[model samples]
Target: MTSHQPPLWRRAVAEMLGTALLVCIVVGSGIAAQQLSPNDVGLQLLQNSTATVLGLTVLILMFGPVSGAHFNPVVSLADWLLGRRSRTGLTLAELGTYVVAQMVGGIGGSVLANAMFEVGTSISAKDRATAGTLLGEVVATAGLVLLIFSLAATRRGILAAPAVGAYIGAAYWFTSSTSFANPAVTVGRIFSDTFAGIAPSSVPGFVLAQLVGAAVGVGLLVLLFPAASRMADDVVVPHPSQKDGS
Candidate 1:
């Protein structure tokens, strides 16, 4: 085996590529479910839920070591705020690259889905509507951030990646928005003309809700585990968890 460290560029690129892959699995699954059986709402939802759970598990297990598999800006921001993610600060350049890569990956996924099913380009109403939908997003996102900080922040939970996937997957059903906790992923879904797509007008509300959820989760985390603030920085990898210490 060889030992070498990935530069910051490689780490950031990994983040971008991992996020894109995650969005594809999530949004792409929804598109497939719709095309296969539009009338079977129950079956479609089940398929969507199953795919999201399985895909997230795979992504996390694969990329969690690579880029922390953040896939969601809120998760990244929360980690940074708590000092869990300090290697690559949330500078304009970093944020620009992350958002752009995520969007590009999302669009690519949507396009692939569209080509497969011959569907038109448009956001799905169920994915962008209010009431249960929006509320679900806020709650799901909050819970997700809360879980990440609580579990993944410490070395004790480094192996809890699978649990994190299951958390989000189950939250999708309980949450009104089917667990669209990630702002980046949310934005990408808008481009897909599938059951998981969000309307443009509804983007703000979802983002706002997700942010709020993150804040709330952070607050509770602080209260429950006051020591987190002191220990958050310990989670970062030296040289991006390089195969060999640089």
Candidate 2:
């Protein structure tokens, strides 16, 4: 029997649900962090990092089987550019659908956070607009996208799923931005009146930086592993096709 390929609609829906799960975990963790340890700055920050790492690990494992678990737009973009995406990859219509789903899912996470945590009562950070903070956003997001591309997107020979968690977890401390790598998560965090929230004005810069970083990551992958990119283009027929059953 031939293996079945999933329809485009199924992939799009999977993307939507995976993106939503990512946002929900990040935002919900922020709310919980506040409720559990309201006044401890260090603890709150650590909680943010820890929760994000753990949530990502679970989500990656859970949804990877369905849609490759790409909740970040940068990952999708890099995959398209690098040619690891399935078939001819996503058509314009499908790409649009995925983007819309991501945005809507982000908004849904924000709205859920608001309802669950009494949003208006919480105090948002006033320092979100500072130059240092914006710089932090840029660096953090870039690091995340780069990691995704290098780890699993273009270079299939490089590390895969489970290692993605360790890569991100370690980056959180080494990178100045604590690795907020995902745009959807960043957008959702804006609605929460908590430490994790980014100022609305900062979103554009953060996302742009992330895209740049993803491209850079792919470029680096090509530079370091020329054979991989070459392999990316050549169609390798399945080995089992040579079996007597054929």
Candidate 3:
């Protein structure tokens, strides 16, 4: 039995909406955490990370089947690269579309969150540029990609939502940069001046770090799981053939 994949337009819409909601959760929770825990930076991070963990898990579960729920440019790019040989991954056009949708959705989500909190759109003043933070972004993003594809390689794709969410939550505390790990989300964070915000000047570095990390992750995936497997389009939700003994 073959799975009925949605049209490209429909999948694009799913990516847009999912990415928007993910950023909304990130920016909104940061704003809320600031208001709630004004003095304690530790507490603020705890609250923000908790919210992100839950929000990301839910969003992936909700949209994984539709668009693979990438919500991150690097992840989509990695998928395209890994599946290119087999023609099972995204085409170039689809990759471009997904990246555009994710970036636009991230920006829109930041704006929406700011408007909801009655804080007009403002550029973040928080400069997150430092050697330590840059390295942290690289580590965080690489680990994320490794985790995602590792699960696919092992046919443990069903655990992706929880696994990815849990890893992000943990990376928040371990990594110096709080594990932004996503270029689109990093861009969105530039629009909010709250706890999760990153300065515009710092965006380029973070994005570059993430790209480098993605490359590292892909390398690790190849070295660790050298054998080629049918990587799932949506790691959290298997296709029909995977589900049924076709």
Candidate 4:
């Protein structure tokens, strides 16, 4: 039996909704963490990361089948680039749609989160600009892409959801920039003034770093998993074959 695949519009809506929710979890949890753990920075981070991990996992599980649960522009672009030769991944038009949806959803999510807490819409005052933080963003994003593609390449696609959530959770603690690996998420973060927010002035550097990291990730994938036997249909979403006991 062939599994029912959603149309482009439905898939696009899923991507937008999924990304919006992801940002909500991130920013909302950060706000909650700050308020709940005012005295201890470590506790705040711990709370924030925990919520993100669980929330991300749920989102992937919920939307992976419909739209691959991308929620991140770099992931979508990388998927397209890697699968261009096979012609089985996202088309150029689909890629554009995904990116735009993600960006818009991210911004909307930030706004929603801020409004929920009655914080009102305000630009982030937190400045994350610095050589070290920039380096951290590069490293964080590179590791994320590498991990994602590597899993897909190695036929470990089923593990993508949990593994990705776990990696991001760990990265939050290890990376200096707290691992804002998604460019869309980074852009959304600028609109919030909470703990997870980044200053508008700092956005460009972080985005550039993430793009550079994506390139590095592709290089690393080439070096490490030169010839994968099969490619997953989507990074986080399992293909029909994986779902129907094929």
TM-score of each: 0.82, 0.78, 0.94, 0.93
Compared with the true structure, what per-residue lDDT tens digits does model 3 show for residues 1-246?
Answer: 565767778778888999899999999999999999899999999999999999999988898877777889998898888876766667788889999999999999999999999988899999998999999999999999999888888878788899999999999999999999999999988999888889999999999999999999999989998743357464434543222111
lDDT of 1 by residue, 142-191 (tens): 78877766764454556446777788778877876778887787777777
Off by over 4 Å in 1: 1-5, 84-97, 120-127, 230-246
Q: Who is ahead in TM-score, 2 or 3?
A: 3
List pairs with backbone clashes in candidate 3. Answer: none
Top-TM-score candidate index = 3
lDDT of 2 at 58: 78
Clashes of each: 2, 0, 0, 0
Of 1 and 3, the candidate ahead on lDDT is 3
Flag the better candidate by TM-score, 1 or 2.
1
RMSD of each: 3.9, 5.6, 3.1, 3.3
Compute the lDDT of residue 114 as modeled in candidate 1: 61
Can you list the residue pairs that collide in candidate 1? 136-176, 136-177
Worst 10 residues of 3 by lDDT: 237-246
- Please say which candidate is ahead in lDDT: 2 or 3: 3
Q: What would the per-residue lDDT of candidate 4 be over residues 1-246, giving only the tens digit for each residue?
A: 565667778778989999999999999999999999999999999999999999999999998888888899998888778876665567788889999999999999999999898887789999997998888888998998898888888878778889999999999989989999889999999999889999999999999999999889988987998753246365756643222211
Looking at model 4, the pairs that clash are: none
Segments of candidate 4 deviating more than 4 angstroms: 1-3, 228-232, 240-246
Model 1: number of clashes?
2
Using lDDT, rank the candidates from best to worst.
3, 4, 1, 2
